[model samples]
Target chain A: MSEQGPAFDLSYVANLARLELSEEDVAMFEPQLQGILSYMEKLDAIDVSGIEPTAHANPVLNVTRPDEVCPSLPVEEALRNAPKSANDQFVVPKVVE
Target chain B: MSLASQTIKGLQTLLEKKEIQPKEIIDSVAEAAAVRDGAIGGYLGLDQELAHRDAEEISGGVLAGIPIGIKDLLNVKGQPCGCASKILSNYIAPYDATSIAKLRASGGIPFGRANMDEFAMGSSNENSSIKPVHNPWDLERIPGGSSGGSAAIVAADEAIAALGSDTGGSIRQPAAFCGCVGLKPTYGRVSRFGLTAFASSLDQIGPLTKTVEDAAILLGAISGGDKNDSTCLDESVPDYVADLQGDIKGMKLGMPKEFFGEGIDPAIRASVEEAAKQFESLGAEIVEVSLPHTEQAVAVYYIIATAEASANLARFDGVRYGYRAPDAENLGEQYAKSRAQGFGNEVKLRILLGTYVLSSGYYDAYYLRAQKLRTLIRQDFTSAFETVDAIIGPVSPIAPFKIGENASDPLAMYLADIYTISANLAGICGLSLPCGYMTPSDGQRELPIGLQILGAPFDEGKVLKLGHNFEQSTEWHQRRPSLG
Candidate 1:
């Protein structure tokens, strides 16, 4: 994060991003992030009042399928990418006690 | 030249006559890889058996028997879709991405996993955590990224052509640097279902090939409506190859003066100006147009792209699949550690920047403001197309630099995509083809510079026609890097 980021709370933002940074990463990235964020500040000068935000370049109508069960990835294949799996379910750290 | 170096049209003709078997094309590609990949480091993996299986199963698709390299991000069933990052290094794709399925249906065999910047993040291939792709033109210099491997290998003849995803200049910049033909189709022109998401709005899958005609063929194969990707407009895919004939007589080409302004390499600008004159000679009218919002393109792209990327990448949390940090006592620690350890530095920086912008009290200022600027950027194109049939410019401001030259300077690196990023923002088709060369004074050998042709949304046929005509007239696309 940038200096403003640290001032505004980079750890808070990192926690939001779910990325843990090492001391080296923070040290190396801080000045760089500061530079990038400062560059992004250039956007502030533009008067974009009343302009609509474009979420998609070519926005499509909400597509509705027939909702029929199409052939989906088999359970085994779906689980194939999991780092920890059993019984066709991903095993993960406990979410609840 | 080996068969692998031949254009798709050349190979397809021979295949039609039984002059060469499909497997032989795969064999040629394998041979090229053995000779060239060791030096270029363009491929992450190549399975001969898979290539042969694809070749054997060919059903006379349009690009029959041709082997096209697959960028690591796109899913090929049972193949690792690493996206050139360690996070998903162990993950094998469960099914073919729509583009791959369509390409396979066209009889183009997916040959190898080419390297890329981790999750298609950076301007140079140096961002690849797996291995950086070297520019085949000059072994020590960097191939532009995140489609660097796709472009490098196509230039090196390791694969007949390759699939590359362009979020912002991933395909075009690398194509310019490595001297290959790269096309970034209009956003939503090609489905994004199977390809790893970069920024949903800006992300698109296109081709990196040896010729503009080859790009046309591949673009034809992969583009169409997909049930899986809603944004893939129901707009019909045209016969891009058929549009290639006829001179560009009386066609209007716009040269945006903002892009040609100071800070671009004089040599590159001269080459493009020379190309504009060439286009004029070929009967196209070159007109000066202004995209006033051009200066804000890079800034807006970083904000909107990173904001979306922050959201898209949230799926990588160590849960259902992908790399999981070992020995996490809690889910929070797991998410943090997995991303920190799994991603490279640039990825982390972008995520942090994105997360910050989207964070409370800041979202309205940064992300929203950038989005509004994006609309103005798109309007610039809409207005430009009113007078010009297509826009022409240099792909990048400068030639390919040496490895580590801008590695430490992230902002400097981001600025390199200045010429290419707005096309993505505007959701238009853009093509990069060789126009001229930069002969270095130091005897380091000459490097290739590319001329970029951008067309209106779903106007790929027009751009392809323009690029193909130029390619047929000039000998630049014919020049290949000499392999020892």
Candidate 2:
């Protein structure tokens, strides 16, 4: 219930998300982060004792269609959309280098 | 040549009868756009050549040869889909959104791309990095957003109808503010394959049109299973147009007391009450209903939505696609600098809050709890539906506020979405239809107000039928903004 709950530590979350947070952003976000977490704590008091967890409100039925391969946009048309490309693959900065 | 005053249905009738050719309609629509769009700023981009070509190819449908605006968030192949952000300024869609494809199949001419809040983050269209879209009713005011341009374009008759995406009231709020009809179809009812995700769990592509029937026809054409979207349901897509006039003679309508309580404009309350009386005159029963957890909808919605948005937008790290900063020394700096420079203030705030909530210790306390509240909120609707066929309320607390009035305060912007966000969170169908207008005590001018109708999951027909019935009993939808 305290503002100092889980949302305060940005580094822990940044680690989980594989994001590296700057010191400036972490300092700036602390209070705003605390405000959101405290608001969420209000939900902790609600009772759901025998209620079944529903992932989707609408009834979930399998939406299976015949496994048929369909034609896709021609490679030229597809590649025409790439901002930067070499050969047939999208060109990106080398991560390993 | 004043096609600005004509409804989509009226224009369609003219085209079918050959009284006016598609080229003539496009010409008139173009002229209207030139005259009115400058004041309203509804369009982000207008493709006259593409529109003329599509107009020539129009064969038949309820929307035959109708010039329709597409929200910038929806992919329209070969067109810039900037999403009203400088970050995406150079991004052109490689393919059309599924709904856009359906519109083309039905002979809808894509006229232009409408402006929106950047990445669909804000309730006011002012969040758009491009020129702000003004309310056609009053140029000094805002058109409710992130679907503001779509609603304003239809309101100003710049286009016959526009495709809008509703994630937490984006379509309906703008429709309400701009004095038009907008429908948010049930989740997974329409394909979301090409939509730029804001909050995936809440997003549904819907229609912003001049009338309820147009909304229904548009919904019928777009709603169905798509192999590209796994969330799409396999349920049978009923002909919404065919079911438009079904009898709701004795159906029960729930009037939630909480929605009509304090903070709602008195004029809006009167307007909705009058609409309820009209529904009763049509033999429908008005039953008072309680959605006990209604007050908590906004609080729960923000937490869950931002969490989902954080996850969805994580892909835009300037790595695989989109704009990357050129001066970065390493990958880490590249992502940070790119996202920081690319995203707008509101977008950045949400991303920060989302990352905070979903972070290690916070995930259990904030994200998990919010998900559980979402269940309770859905349950409230489930139980309420047992007593009534539909629920009614004001689409927003007040008519469109003056432009720039709420831009500085983020909380004020979020408050405008209070009444409309719950339906999206609960994954149900809802519609906003013009009911009446708000005339201040000083009597300067009357601004429009809307009556929102919400129905059970996949009950769009019932929602549309009720909305159509209400429109039939009132002249609100027929009244156009005086832009001349």
Native interface contacts kept by each candidate, as a fraction: 0.89, 0.19
Tens digits of per-residue lDDT, candidate 1, B186-291, equal 9989999999998999999999999999999999999999999988987888899998988899999999999899889899999999999999999999999999
DockQ, 0 to 1 scale, candidate 1: 0.82
Q: Which candidate achieves the best TM-score against the true structure?
A: 1
State the lDDT at B389 in candidate 2.
Answer: 97
Residue-level lDDT tens digits of model 2 in A1-97: 5546542556665544434456676665555556555555666667755555444556557767799998887776665645467887766566695
Q: For residue B453, give model 1's deviation from the true position in Å.
A: 0.6
lDDT of each: 0.91, 0.82
lDDT of 2 by residue, B257-309 (tens): 88988788888999999999999998899999988877777777888788888
Clash totals, every prediction: 0, 0
TM-score of each: 0.98, 0.93
- The collision pairs in model 2 are none
Model 1 reproduced share of reference interface contacts: 0.89
